[model samples]
Target: MSYTKTQTNPTPFPLVKVGMGHLKIATAGSVDDGKSTLIGRLLYDTKSLTTDKLKAIEEKSKQRGFDYLDFSLATDGLIAEREQGITIDVAHIYFSTPAKSFIIADSPGHVEYTRNMVTGASNAQASIILVDARNGVIEQTYRHFFINNLLRIKEVIVAVNKMDLVNFSEEKFQTIKNEINYLATKSDFEAQKITFIPISALNGDNVVEKSTKMSWYQGETLLDYLENIDTTLTNDSANARFPIQTVIRPKTAEYHDFRAYAGKIYGGDFSVGDPVLVLPSLTKSTIKNIYFFDQEFDTALSGSSVSITLTNDVNVSRGDMIVKIDEIPTIAKELEATICWMDKEPLQNAQKYYLKHGVNDVQAKITHLSTILKTDFSGVEENTTALTLNQIGDIQIKVSKPLFFDTYKKHKYNGAFILINPKTNNTVGVGFIKSPL
Candidate 1:
């Protein structure tokens, strides 16, 4: 894994705008586990819902002869889902607090829709895994926990819902906690921060507000935990990665000589006059200006969406990367990765596919199938040949050209990619780059 650099300083440029900060969260659980109800409870308790929406929910609940409001009606929007009383797609809900804004991805929990759950949790900073108190831990719990561990979500909130039905028993809570704790030791995600909260989404106890019956429990409410979490827990700031999305060249009179490359900064910050390498081609350039909308800035930190103008007019375009010359990614043509197969048809051994990494999409082929990972995250199935839908497996792929990448543990944003079936133009799998070619 290696890359070369070329240095060139062109013209002095203007400043760039600042960045925006927000937290992204996702919710998961097995069917009938109150995932949607918990989200509705959060929104309702926080006063994020409108008066009309509340009235509508009340009317629908009464018409259905329900004594209590069905909060799940707030997000289960699909016609089929509403008729079936199950979540079938991803619902992205927005809410804001004084400390930080949040984007909640409500994902489906059924085993058949595990692919949609993966899509929802892929970009989340934290996740909420709901458990039905009556059922305790079950098979679907293992599946959801496995997905969370695989995605490397920083925080896990094991929300034990429907506590009211169980009489808010301390013994039941402890039992579930012990079970999850035991399973945590068997997983590869031991470093994750796990928090447990007992709540009744139907009655709104211990979810948004503290429960009076559960006097023995003493901890911050779920809302408090979510709002007070440190921003640093979401991403990394050590290694810097920039994948170029497009080359912006203003062929005008006022800025006739300007050449800018637009992309999002991933790992660390990039300052003006910092030396960079244009990957694959190994061309070198200096950062002259960083632009966010219409302002100027001296440096752009990780996760900032900005356009950077270079000192030299090298052959750079979409799919190319602008990275620090000294800290380049591994350049290779073969890769070993963990893949989550999403397509209905199982993976074919000799088929060619397109790998979309960052903003670059390139042709690739599956050269070897190594092992299939169990849902418990304990170990892999050695000597496997193919992966079926919703199956996770280790595979070796050969790409048409070398890709600049890092391990998923080091840099998730740059080390992750999606596999597309070229003929159907459909995403077939979600993959994490495990190592260089």
Candidate 2:
């Protein structure tokens, strides 16, 4: 495949430019789809791998009696994974170019490890769905595709891997692309942008470098597309939300008067004097000052950790959110959610547990069992009494106190929460809250 910067969105601050920014992506596919090899190729080609790591990889390949350097040896971390020649967990790899920094989560491809893939892809802005060029598509491919859509990943790169095994035939690549398109059309996603690339992870063709044999293909290499992607296209830069983590009061000689609310901005922008409301109490306040680290700032953007002082000290404390008054999310005691059962035991009705929403944790009970989702098809089995491990289901829960939340589709940070077993302190379920109820 070769990529140039297609578009660049201008930002007032030179450092905040879109196309020339870091991007986080997750990679998924069925078993033995070469995800690890692809990641190693990216690190090696970009010269981001340290000399020692590269040398260790070469030595390991030789130890295994391989003629060519086995790139998968670089990321297959677990002993069982190395022995089985499969990725059994998520391995986070970091690399960067002059254009942008990259974090790739190489997730396990086996059916049993679907939860691991979900954990890795939850925070990703883009995802790569790999398909073996020889095998085309299968049922696991449908499951992966469904999860990608469910997570609302904006960009999907359908990498048809191991093209060298198929003689780098353009027909094979086209067939895989067509199959993916058909599968995508059947999904309930927002019609994400899908790019088809033919590559051999083992041979490193069309990965970081253009393939010479594929003269018929005239497109950007995988790395090129990744590096030049307009990251602003996938960002939610509109809504302003800041969940207060701690009330900062540095009791010092010079900073005795400082009473700042410290927290990371979940979404949106904050100006010097924007009208904001403190949630869980609904007390109104206005920003008096915004301080990032030790420096006093006039504004703070999303993902930036900062502290703010309110005009009225209306008893705001830890776990309280300061958001635009008109844009405050719904506060309710009862909630409907889509949950992924994470425990070995099934989720039973009338069971009381702890619900951890953002920084605020509360006790909750399962009031009703709505439905269990069937992964193969986008349908539900209603009136389910309990949810087993790896099962996705609709549930109604009532909490001891009201929670400030948004629908999962609207605001991911607020929409998502986790269920914990109070007795064991283990996370048993991951859930996305349903809105307007």
Candidate 3:
């Protein structure tokens, strides 16, 4: 595997504002599959590496008696990782091309580290699953794809790394692509879009620049494909939901009547004239004004933190929600959710835990351990007694009070919750509401 630096110039790609410029990408692949090298090559090819960082990598590579630079050293930060030549923890690598900035979560591919993979990819907008050309699709490939499916990640790139080892054969690439396509059909998620790219990450072919060796792949380079992604389209929502984080009241005597609900809007935009209903109490209100610090706006877009005043000073507090009347979510005390268990202790039926759903915390008890979903896209494992570490399953939970929520498929922002052990205060699991019960 070899590439000349002149194939393309590396330039700093400015991370875009809020929702436009930054891309969060998670990566998973088996050991020796070149995940770290791909990340390092991206940094190096894009001129994102500092002189000192490059020097450190170069010195490490040489000390190990390697003639060629070991790009993997760039991301394997931990001493254990350096010694083992494998990624154990999720190492976040940031870089940019001239078009867009990127944040890559280099998650481990080992089965035992599945929890880390879930944690790393839970909030990612995109993912990359690396496969060694010589080995084709392996067990870790299936696990990585399953994680993407479970998280409902919309866009995925199947990067066939180390293509040089397979002599850059077009037939080999197609074989792997067909396997992945077949696997996608088995996923419970129906609309996970996937793109295939054959590349030698170490050689930098078909990554920043198209590969000349395989003239067969007439597609955008990896970087070009990433740059062209419109995140807004992939992450669009229409149901306006505003979960109030706090009530803002200036005690200063000059403005004694100023009252506002402070929170970040999700799902859709909200204008001053939009009619909304406060949850739990079902209090009716109209948006009077929107304020960000001191500046004011007639409308507030999703992903913005702002304070909004309502025409009515109706009783509203933290944990209450302001939502468009037409798009009101299910108000329920019991929930049916798909949970990914993260704690070392198995999740037992009827266990009491504290569940925190976006800005709202409540006491919860497991009503049932329905079934464990297999990670290979196979059907569920029935009659499961308990959910063990790194296992995913469906469960019923009863909260202390009625809450406003949506299905994970409908509104990811308001549908997710975390289970914390009351004794240790450690997060035990992450749950996505499948539906209100």
Candidate 4:
């Protein structure tokens, strides 16, 4: 997408602030789906590509005997990727306009790299799923969309790419759109807000600006939509959850008797004098002060890393949670969750593993394996005894101690956990809490 010098926005977009101005987006699709090319196009159009990098892409494209500059050369950073012509790891491409900065996660497309796709895009606020206009909506397309749905991404831009290959046929674009819409109805999950756009990333059509070849598309360009999309709200809950990471106490004689609980606040906001409850002990207290370094503030919102001091001398320790009295989460030892197996070893019944939930680590045992969820988001397969690599399933887990958590549907951060193999110490699977069992 190239913005010619002539065409410019009269009412410019807002300038990005230091902390809140940028957006994180993840791109996913099957091999040869133009994920890298789309990213390269965005970088090029926005003038984010350095001269050396652009020269490198040009040289690489020439070496491959290509007539046009292959934008995919910009993102295939790994030697293996260049040799195999497939993405193996998540390549983060950074670009910025005057209005905002964007971080695009170019995730792997192969079936075996599904774990990388999940971990790379888990924190992204939005996603772009590339569909080959020739292939339309294939299995990998369904898998990519299904994973995006599982991640609870609020906004999805389905780019129907390679329109030039199909002679810019509106009929082909509409057919792909209909198939996707029909496939969306097969799942019970609430499909996210989907916006379809037709583009030819190679020729820079409908990327940064409208394509003259296809005047049929009436929607905004990809960059325009991203600039205007609402990313303020996410999948995380609105209630505040402050999990104590550590305690800070001053031993110096300058002005002794200083103690603060330091942790990053998730969700909601906390203000001085707010009624708060300490977890496990269930002690009641009021917030006395909130501090960032030497400065003190009246309140701190979600995503703030500040030290908090309570009114009374409360016995709070690491791994304990502090939340609003009325916003206390469920405390339990057993939970039902959707599990994504990431390791080569299969997850079996009664398998012992170490579970890591936020700042706390505890022993966990898989009590039962439920059903294998098809990647296509079709129903489930019963009598599934093991969850293999790259498979999504449901299971029951019993932790060593009661955990203060919420369902993943309600609180994303508090509701997810990782299972580490005790023997290998490798992260074997990630679980999204469904409910307390």
Candidate 5:
């Protein structure tokens, strides 16, 4: 078999835009299941890697006494990861095609690195869960899938890798696909779109190019699917939410009265003449002007970081949320959230921590541990006592101040928070707001 290097240009496909800026993907699988190799294969096949990178892979593969190029080297950048042949941290990779730009978060698959996986998948719009054909679906596979479901990732690609080891057996691929399909029926995210493909990351079959060995398979390659997948967020449909990051004031002789609230739009768009409400203070104001740097825009869409001058100065400051007057979020001192515990210390009731919701921070305490969720998507263990490291559970929390937020399902950016250990100043947990409690 000959390994021919291809140029880094994507083949033309039907142009499709989902109104999203860039696509973010998280990859997960069991150890030695070729998760890193699959990513490496994608980069290699896409011609995203530089000449030095290809040379490095060739030298490393020869040094390791491997006949084929070790594509895993392309993503496993850490010295410990390269030495141990296991990914320990999340490695972010950026590459673009003619159709779209992509950011892949290569997450660790070890059982202990479940926290790491959550960190990667939290911001991802899609997920790629790899399953070794020889091993089929295992415990780790269930955990990864559960995380994707919990995050509400709408799209998933289940790549049954190492087809070469299975002699390109169609039966083996079908069995694995059937297993995942059955698992999906039990998942909370029943509407998730899952695509299964047989691939050999080592030999680059069905990753970027069609696999001649599996002639019965008539689906697009993994690259084809990702390039055309719709990754648009639902922010367009949600209410406008802009958490004030800072107050922009130019104390100059010429523009001494310029005071504007600066932040990124987290939800729907905002227009110049829109009626806005300042949260907590409940101050009413009208947008006088929207400025993106020196240029002014009539309207600002979600995710755009800009400054807005209000018609009246109602004492707005940092941590204040400016939202549409008609579509106000729940403002409450107590909240119910699904939290993924990340610290080594178990999450106990009455434990105080600093909760950061967007740019706002407030003192919070866990009031109740409702239930400990099982990661296998089987069922929930109700009335759980505590959540240990890497365990996810539902809890009620009391905050020092009222928080203006939406449900995570409704608005992702406005619904997420991080619990900081006040004493140690470390981030201990991540929470997704369910509703005001």
Candidate 6:
């Protein structure tokens, strides 16, 4: 089964930038899909690895009696991972090219570690899903793509790896590409952009340099694409949302009257004189000032950790949210959400848990068990009674206090929450708010 070259769009070589900004990337694929090797290749070919690291890899590779360097050793950091030759936890690798700095999260591929993959990919602006050229599209590939779509990661690169093992065949790459494209049509996120690239990570083909073996392929190397892709687009462009983490008060003589709310801006920007409303209390006030450390600023953008003072001294404390007057989020006690169960214990109806949404922690209980969703793009199972580990499902939850939140699609930071088991204090599930119920 093969697809024609015209079936996939040809990627034009991107012009390299001198100094691009930072990018966070998460990798996903089944076990032995060469994910770690691809990352190691990126570091080695880009001259990002230090001398000591290279020497250690060479020594280890030789001791193992391998002809080529065991590039997977660069990212398989844990002893368990190295011994088993599989990633158990998310391994973060930081490297820089002349054009950009990258933080790659090497997520585990085993079925039991699906929660780890979700955590690794939650903050990524882009993702790279590796598919073994010899093994086409598999079940794990579907789960990876689904999670990326669920997280609203706009950019995805499907790197068909291990071309060397398959004799650098273009047909193999096309088959996998077609399978993934078909799956994309079933995805809820229609705007997700996917690019297909054929590469052999072990042999350094099409990773950092153009591959002569597959001359029929026409696309920028993996590094070239990473260097040129934009990382500025984020959910921060949505309505302004600031969740107060702490109330700062300097009772000292010089700044006796200063009462500022401190937290990182999650979405949109805030400026002096902007009308804002404090949540739960519903008190209104205008922004009096913004401060980052000891410095003062007229405006603070999203992701900025700054202290803000309101024109009126409305009583505010930790876990309180502030939002723009015009773009207020939903304030409700009951809501419906999609959740990924992460704990060993199954999720049951009317189960009590501590729901931590951003900086706010509230007592919450699952009131109703909805449908359990299939991760392979298959339709949902209706009337699901319970949710087990690695299972995703929809459910109705009632919180002790009103929550200020938006749908996950509308605002990433403000729309997510974690369910902590009251008795064990362990994160049992992660949820994305769907709507007020």
lDDT of 1 at 434: 89
Of 2 and 5, the candidate ahead on TM-score is: 5
Backbone clashes in model 3, listed as residue pairs: 13-97, 16-21
TM-score each candidate.
0.93, 0.92, 0.95, 0.95, 0.94, 0.94
Stretches of candidate 2 exceeding 4 Å from the true structure: 1-20
Report the lDDT of model 3 for residue 311. 94
lDDT of 1 by residue, 224-249 (tens): 78877776766655578888888787
Better of 1 and 4 by lDDT: 4
Mind giving the per-residue lDDT tens digits that candidate 5 earns over 306-356? 999999977988999999899999999999999999999889988999999
Quote the positional error of residue 268 for candidate 2 in Å.
0.6
Clashes of each: 7, 3, 2, 1, 0, 0
- Model 6 over residues 338-387: C-alpha lDDT tens digits? 99999999999999999999999999999999799899888799887899
Superposed Cα deviation of residue 377, candidate 6 (Å): 1.1
lDDT of 3 by residue, 267-335 (tens): 899999889999989988899999999899999999899999999879999989999878889999998
State the displacement of the C-alpha of residue 57, model 6, in Å, after optimal TM-score superposition.
0.9
- What TM-score does candidate 4 reach? 0.95
All candidates: CA RMSD (Å): 9.4, 4.4, 2.4, 2.4, 3.3, 5.5
* lDDT top scorer: 6
Write out the backbone clash pairs for model 4.
1-208
Global Cα lDDT for candidate 6: 0.88
